[model samples]
Target: MRAKNSFLLLAVILLSGCFVSKDTPKKEAKEDPYEINNQQDNRSLADVLRKYSSLTIQGDGNNARIYIRGQSTISLETQPLFIVNNTNMGRNYAAVNSSINANEIVSVRILRSLSETAIYGEEGNHGVIIIKTKNANK
Candidate 1:
């Protein structure tokens, strides 16, 4: 009887230790509106931007359009903080990203609300279009 009791106690302790108090990381209270992951370049852009193509994405495999708002422009020298792979993308980044390299993008996220705009400060006055690539790596 004592051996059985001891074995039961030991099992209980072992099982108790294995259980974690946390429940699914407690789920964040609230996520930031603009708190986004590192924008990747995993898009399927097969066609390059040609003449006067309205800002259209994820349409056909051809005719990709690169988006750039005026507020993102800085001192006429640098454009908006084009962030990609955590690296500030240059103007060429759009050219390269939109070029018919691999495939067209899957989708584009436009953040215009003050909640989203406030993060970028004045730089996002014109608005912000977060480009998410289709197949690009992080």
Candidate 2:
């Protein structure tokens, strides 16, 4: 009889917690770039992203993770259009990371709004961060 009562009591407590949830809506565990806020103190561009994000941020002088907003537009039927120095930067954008010289960069800007990504179309689904670099001659 004691074992039965104990089990019943445990179940009641468990069920009660489900009915009495807090103010925040329950969210499933998932990756969210929004988890990292830019409001924190200024560290080097590389340090800021490397600290908060789960991904490894590797390179030289400076690096950044720009968080622009996702878009609903899906105009491109095939692949993404990645522009580098005003030209198409090819499909393997991630691979090109190693090729980027951090010392040549000026500053990186992050845009976290849907309006900001709409211009780029659907490739900016999670967001699009356009990286602007200094001219090689400079």
Specify the highest-TM-score model's number. Answer: 2
**Model 2: per-residue Cα lDDT at residue 16:** 83
The regions of model 2 sitting more than 4 angstroms off are 1-83, 87-93, 136-138
lDDT of 1 at 126: 45
Error of model 1, residue 20, in angstroms: 46
What's the TM-score of every candidate structure? 0.34, 0.38
Q: Which ten residues in a row have the lowest lDDT in candidate 1?
A: 46-55
Candidate 1 lDDT by residue in tens digits, 34-76: 3333344553432322111333333444333344333334455
Each prediction's total of clashing residue pairs, residues at least 3 apart in sequence or on different chains, is: 13, 1
Against the correct fold, how does model 2 do in TM-score?
Answer: 0.38
